[model samples]
Target: MSPSLFTSLDVKSGGGTAVFSFLILLLLKMAFDTFGYKMGMNPWPGVFGWYCNPAYRLFDFLLGYTGFLVLEKTDLKVSSWKISVIQCVTLVFYFAACHLFDKQWVPAPFILLTLVLIFAFTLPGGIFNAIFGNRVLTHLGNISFELYIVHQVNINLMNHTLLKWTGNNHLLVFFMLLVISWLMAEFFSLNPIKRFVTKSIYKSKIFI
Candidate 1:
């Protein structure tokens, strides 16, 4: 059983990436979080709700592209002050995400909250390179994508199945899921699998 694939269904102000000025982007995102859906769903089905899914994809794409830009910077310098501010905002977003919001990522608050945090930490001041550029973090980030794809469904299945037989143990369920997800991530990230994927994609005319 894969973790349920679902996005949050919630209210939104929209127009963060375009039309709005700089500050409004952040504001609108936070606003969505504050006003959007307030709960998580059990794994979603193919495709997601209308409002949030496209926004999520755009935000994520921009984040990765921004990281690439940061890494490629030739001579730009980032002030420590800006990094500090971003870090502070990132923490704020995290606080709101965990405490002020509900469990779902796609609905109102969680979607905006989580994405703002990503932007806060990864979007500016060359922090992307400074942090994820580290060898370990980079490797994890690579597999992290694949892990995100495979880990959740299986873990959720495990949790559901185990809860019935073993009753309920938070520690046991979380620990097992974490460990298993890591192993599965590692397996998908292994050299052989990586090469196979690369070659397959390379040979595919669809990519070309």
Candidate 2:
């Protein structure tokens, strides 16, 4: 999670190569899944059935590499509005692609479109960073891992409790979850107890 990890020489070299390999593997897995379903054959069986699909391994591999690449390549500083817009667009495209091409394998056209969108959205930030430097981006990057860890637990608890009281108001639940997750992330990031625990566990290499 440390920003330093992203820019390490090892990551830039091996990590990038690993990511590209994983993407290729993922395409292979999708092919397998499609073939299996079409032929009415259950190719994978037993416990760990899900992992039998090559897709899962490819995904994990991609995440490992792409995450490092993103950290290394992008300025972490971005306005919330810009971040939200990118997220919304990405989600829309992902769902649209899924719905439109459910039976088809990952369409090359959609993949190319996605890559174009990513580069386009990133250009403004790249230009700004060239002129203004990356101080804001680096600071913003620090909070990301902490936010990821805290948000899910905070949201899940708030969602369940709110549902019991409010009779399934999705909007209210969503907003509350967002607000509470942010607050919890902020709190945990600063809390002495949490810091102590995190450092202790990390030092021991016991949590992973």
Candidate 3:
């Protein structure tokens, strides 16, 4: 569940470990999916209905710690562009490998490229901070935790209700889910509820 206790090590080492874990999880998921498809089986376990599978749990744990390690190690003088670059390269390689091996990898490259573009956009701000001694992307980075948490719940709830009522229209459902989730995240992040919950949990050190 929680990362190993040793995850509190130096940020760079922790980050490297987290990234390694993520890559391992991603590869494992691909292997599982491949084997499942070949055998005509569902890839995810039944409990949690697709959310709390071993692959997802492993990746989520690594990603959460990666963010923590990045925040811990961040310095105004040092650019975080290197981490972004490494993330992008790893994502690209993972997708490329999937595409090479799987006939169903059509969406993998597109998804990975979108993530790479997002990281690339942040790279400039990181470079500016390193050169001009300003924390340009600090605020954007800070809200990311709240955004991640809120977005997933919003998306899942919206998708489930819409599908139940309207039946399956995949593209329409996806766009609606995306728009609703982003709006919900933005709204919730600006409200006092966000601050109250975050402070009550993280500040109180009750759920660390």
Mark the regions of model 3 whose C-alpha exceeds 4 Å error after superposition: 1-92, 100-142
Model 2 lDDT tens row, 84-191 = 566567657877877888766533344444554445345454433443346754543455555555555555445678988779888888888877766665676676
- Predicted candidate 1 versus true structure: per-residue lDDT over 61-180, tens digit per residue: 333433333333334356867776777878776786677544545343444455555555664554455766688877787776666665546654577777666678877878878888
Deviation (Å) of 143 in candidate 3: 3.8
Listed in order, each prediction's TM-score against the native is 0.52, 0.47, 0.44
Superior by TM-score: candidate 1 or candidate 2: 1
Output the better candidate (1/3) by lDDT.
1
lDDT by residue for model 3 (14-94), tens: 447645654564465556545554454665544432333434443444544443444444443435767555555755776
Q: lDDT of candidate 2?
A: 0.53
Candidate ranking under TM-score, highest first, comes to 1, 2, 3
> Alpha-carbon error at 103 in model 1, in Å?
6.0
